[model samples]
Target chain A: MAEPCTRWDAEGRLATERGETLDAHFAACPDCLAARAADAALSARLVETGARWQPPGDWEARVFARIAREAPARRFSWWYALFPALAAAGLAVFFFAPRGGGGPGSPDPSGAGFEVQIGVVDGAQVVRSENPKPGDTLRLTARVPTRDPARVAIRIYRDDRTLIFACGGGEVPCSLADDAVRAEVLMTAPGAYRSIILTGAGPLPAPAGTLDADAAAARAAGASVTLGEAVRVW
Target chain B: MTPTEDNPTTPPRASSDPGAAEQAVLALLERDDRRGALTALMRLYGDAIYRHCYGTLLDADLAADVHQTVFVEAWRDLPRFSGRSSFKTWLFAIARHRCLDALKIGRRRRSRFTTDDDAPEPADPARDAETDLAARSMLPPLENCLGGLRAESRTAVLLRFQESMSYEDMGKLTGELAGSLQARVARAMPVLRKCLEAAGVSL
Candidate 1:
């Protein structure tokens, strides 16, 4: 008498990894044959179902229009005059400012003043301002002071406010005590990119959607810094 | 009815020489003729990409958004494409990620609302019926059955059967072990069969 086939045997049969034992079992076993037939029928149905879908005729045009509207900006060589002042202020805050006791309404208890600098990593040096090509890698470095180990979140967005990348949204939010935090972002296209840094006594909200909304949410949460920079690729 | 059923004049498969077409697009992109390259790329893979997106996302609007994002990201990242993988694979990877992101957003919204009543409604049935009538399609039952599936299972089934992908290719695209993917597909089949049966599908 042939032994009854197990589900694994049926799986083997489905995978076409049939052995003599399974072949003999299926030859004698009505149940196994039925199961195999059911599986095949299901697979066929799924394939047929998948084939039935057809995107609209103008789907390509719609896609093209969307990309046209949302695509990253092309390389722009004109440096924004405001960035130099902002960079200078950031440097001054990082270097000369005194650490006061945690201020009223400040999220950080250690009175850690936050500063973020966006730059392109040149060979062995971080350049504060440079026209990065499309494929260049940019570095975001932040100095955050914390009392206890705290959470830090960073979100980068394109000019259109679409999310580029986000960290600190999941189980392992970025942790920092009192040091500089750095993340590398690959430049995908030439665009005005914004980086928002959030550090708080608790988990920070993950940024989604446009830049204005993200900034507003981060500000509402009480501890965040937003920085914007432009890149050109040609 | 599928496109093959209704359309007597489907465009001949874009070209016999996909490699040549890909190369020409890449050349245009490299030369900064982004608009021209994009148009060419669209003509080459637009329908297939849209279908993949629609299958994965299960919503035409979301799929369209993901479709756009894939190309926008592709344009940005084209320079970084090492050509280690085929262009189709790379484009599909982007589409998958964008779809996943959209799913995450949808999940977040659903979770935040906290009530079943607050969940998004299905597409307007009247509009869908009109579209279906015009297209002479009968996929709504299948769509309903697919909607009943766990997202992972649905994705596995779509990638395997609809995309006609090998287990190895599916594993690469999904970042799962091939054996695990095989198991997932195996588990998904029975559930899908049951769902379809319950939905009164002949299968």
Candidate 2:
């Protein structure tokens, strides 16, 4: 039996670089040849008509202005070099700051001793810690590194799975929750933890250091913490 | 291979006629006269790019956006243009990528004004008939037939027939291998042809 002819159309082929194989087939196949002729007629008409359409007034100028204004800043910035230093300081403060009971690395006062810090991450921000244990609390403080003052979203993933997420929405200077930073979720089992702070809707993976420290600090800080069936902390 | 061992004696083919405009634009841009370059590009290929975009997008507003983006991106990346390919070809490549992306976005957003709905009203059937009576147009029937194709088919056809680019270039723009692209085009032609013939177009 002859092979069944597959359904094909001109638009898809036209979008392709090399001319369509269907065109070659059409050159021989009477049915396809007829269709190709009709398409050619319609294309010319559309092209002629489309050429007359004009853009809105001042659109080009506006686009030009926007491009000019944003172009230079999009280039490499000098502030990139100071990131590690700033991160060290933030991590030091987060590690050194008194926990829920007023002692450095103290577990949550009420809940399972988990404290999550949510805030803007500056270019210089970093998370730090030594060792982490279960029942211990982890405290995170983020400082987003953007001059625009837009709040970024913080999402934590443990062992490649989501754990907690917090963001200030549109509020300036970012936001923190009542007891924790923004929101907190417990990690029942933890091997390697990751927190990704996205600048926008798309997945902008936080730098490698951002999450390692948050998870490590959370584990180390929360060591020796007791858990209740239902406990509520800020 | 060393230049002496290779076909070094052969002369380079002159660049496409359209490349002169790009060269001129580059010269002006190099002098920091981006405005002049924009004007020159507009004058040289504005109508072609606009119409091509319109054909691909099927909406005037979207076409305009694509046009603006193409030029803006072109200007921004002009400094990085290495001149490895013909300028017009490069521009067309950019336009093709933008058109495909715009179409994808439009589809995801459930766009209504596709190329299928963008046919021009015949100003005068009698006059057009009279003009067609004398002028031997190559692809009128095919154009109307394109509207009936799936989005992918329509785009492929337009890029191939209207823009007249090589298969290799299409592969680069669409991220499809040559064999795959060829297979798709082969599969697409019959549907397009049948649609065209049904639209009262002569083979």
Candidate 3:
């Protein structure tokens, strides 16, 4: 039996390795000739129509303009109106709670003074807020004073489980940006949560159970740690 | 920290490499020039995205809506974009999800993808100006045959033929295995062949 004709069958030979000009085989095999012709024709048609479905000329301008006009998902919710109060409230409640070192004049081991800002994910834009609605994705963006490489992580303390964001894992996703070390934690449900940012020359220390415990652990991490900032989520 | 000096927005797209646009986008992003980055990105992937949305959704308004949503979502996620996947792949991933979401809502009646293949083609609908299908009384036979295909097969064929995407790239965009995409195109071919034959259209 002759080998079946396919594209690999080249120059009309069903099995060329046997070194036969199989022109007689192709002549006898009408199905093979028709199939081959049909395949080539189909391929040609596909190529011909490849450039057919061009998008409209104004598509780019119109789409970009629409993007410009429709704001990012910044509905701001009802809570945006309460930012000033929330900011002050955070300073009182969480700020004074307990901070170990790396303050304004504290031993500056990392050589960088950092400002940590927290916000809710509004579309791709992160709107700065210490108080984000329950279920809001919490974005962490911080500026370290030094140009040195600094690794940043976020540990959000919840009643059930303390979530940590450091390079990997979906629970708390963290990716170190070149200019800004950024992380985002999904605050799944409305609950009491205390979120803290941990930065270090090396890897950050894992949380030690509770928010306060984690804070103590961070402070103990010492010169190994870059900087720390905490936010209280109501 | 924002760059003290704005990095050059002019893209470093060397002529030789295929990934030049993506590189340009990354360069803009590295400079913290988001607006510039967006411009570069839109220029790179905008047409493919808009076409995918339109072809998948089959309605001008819904496709336009999804196209904008995908870009808006892409802009929002720019800070978080880790470049883990090729920018084109990642953006199409978003496009696919938004398309699914629109489908789930039964948005704009997907009858374009759903109407029976044997049934008469629904009166062709909407803006020829937006579609560039103006001044045509009816689509050519192949197009009508293409529209008659099952949605998945139609999408596979169109992406292969119209968008000129490889099976691997289509797999990444559609979340289907490359082999599955290959089989889809294969399955589509015979249906297309039969339809074309019935229409008395050669090739």
- What would the per-residue lDDT of candidate 2 be over residues A21-82, giving only the tens digit for each residue? 44466457654444455456555644454545556655556457666786786453211221
lDDT of 2 at B2: 23
DockQ of 3: 0.10
Q: Residues A1-234, candidate 1: write the lDDT tens digits.
A: 876556633364446521224446566667667667776787787677666666677655665566556544334312222234344554222211123344543234343455555556666676534335556666665554443323555677764356777655342333232455456777786455656555554555566476556654554565444344333221
Instruction: Pick the lDDT winner.
Output: 1
The residue pairs in collision within model 1 are A75-A232, B1-B137
Off by over 4 Å in 2: A1-234, B1-16, B104-148, B196-203
- Predicted complex 3: CAPRI docking category: incorrect
For model 1, report DockQ.
0.22
Choose 1 or 3, whichever is better by DockQ. 1
Single out the weakest 10-residue window by summed lDDT for candidate 1 chain B. Answer: B116-125
Against the native complex, each candidate's DockQ, computed on alpha carbons, is: 0.22, 0.10, 0.10
Q: Give the lDDT of residue A79 in candidate 1.
A: 29
Model 1: how far is B97 from its true place, Å?
0.6
Candidate 3 Cα deviation (angstroms), residue B53? 2.7
Worst-scoring 10-residue span by lDDT in model 3 chain A: A91-100
State the lDDT at B45 in candidate 2: 61
Runs of candidate 1 exceeding 4 Å displacement:
A1-10, A17-22, A71-122, A125-138, A142-234, B1-24, B27-33, B115-139
